[model samples]
Target: MGWLLLLAAGCSEIVFAVSLKFNDGFTKLWPSVVTGISGIGSFYLLMLAIRTLPLGTAYAVWTGMGAVGVAVIGVVWFKEPADWVRLASIMFIVVGIVGLKLTHAE
Candidate 1:
């Protein structure tokens, strides 16, 4: 359950981040609203998840997963550059997330 909450929080973070591109630096009203709401919700869920998970592990998983998801969204939806270096860095983030989850018993 805690893991699920953490993953949901990560997804929310990704949603907020990807939506930022459309926000036009908060000049666009609707996207900015969505970004703000989702960002708040993500933080709320992250705090809930941290209640059960170790702080370091929870923070790593949340940020790492969010970064990977947002990067993929940027590449697919926004056509952001998908160079080999960027892809490799994302892969490293995935590896680190997996390692953190595997080693975190609680």
Candidate 2:
């Protein structure tokens, strides 16, 4: 269940991050509002995940996952530059997240 909570937190982080692209610098009303709510919710879930997971490991995985997810979204959905170097960096973030999850002490 702790892992599930952590995953949920990571998802929320991704949502908040991707929504930022649509927020128009917080000018677009609906997307900005959604982004604000999601950002708060992400932080809330992250705090909950920390209750059962080691703070260092959980935070590293959460942020890494969020970064990777947002980078992918930026590339695929927003047509942002996703050159080989950027893709490789995102892959490293995924690897780090996986490694932390596997090695994290319960």
Candidate 3:
């Protein structure tokens, strides 16, 4: 349950990040609304997750998920660089997230 909450939080974080780009520095209307909603949703879900999960582990996984997700979105949706180095770095973040999940007890 905690992991599921964290995953939802991460996805919300990804949406929050991507919406920031479209928000035009909060000058836009709909995008800004989306950003605000998703940002709050992410934090709320993460808070719920941390109730049962280790705080350090939950925070690290949350951030790692956001970073990797945004990077992938940048590459695919924005047509940003897909160079080997960038891809490898994203993979490393993923590995770390997975490692934290697997190693976590209770």
Candidate 4:
């Protein structure tokens, strides 16, 4: 359940991040609204996840996965280049997340 909440937080983070591209520095209307709402939801879910999980573990997973997801979104949706180092770093983040989970006391 806590993991699910954490994933939800990460998803919200991705949404807000991608929306930032469309938000046009908060000049746009709809994208800015979406960004605001998703950002709030992301932090709320992050708080909930930390209720059951270690703060450091939950925060690392949330930010790490959010970063990886947004990078993928940038490549696939925005046609950004997927460099080798970027991909490798994403893999490292995945491994780190797994290690945190495995070593988590709860």
Tens-place lDDT per residue, model 4, 19-54, is 998999999999999999999999999999999998
Clashing pairs in 4: none
Q: Rate the local accuracy (lDDT) of all candidates.
A: 0.94, 0.88, 0.98, 0.94
lDDT of 1 by residue, 1-106 (tens): 7899999999999988988888999999999999999999999999999999998999999999999998898899889999999999999999999999899886
Kindly provide the TM-score of model 1 when superposed on the true structure, using C-alpha atoms: 0.93
Per-residue CA lDDT of candidate 3, range 11-47, in tens? 9999999999999999999999999999999999999
- The prediction achieving the highest TM-score against the true structure is 3
Global Cα RMSD, each model = 1.1, 1.2, 0.6, 1.0
TM-scores, all candidates, are 0.93, 0.92, 0.98, 0.94
Lowest lDDT block of 10, candidate 1: 70-79
Those runs of model 1 whose alpha carbons end farther than 4 Å from true positions after fitting are none
Order the candidates by TM-score, highest first — what do you get?
3, 4, 1, 2
In lDDT terms, which candidate is top?
3
Worst 10 residues of 2 by lDDT: 1-10
Flag regions of model 3 displaced more than 4 Å.
none
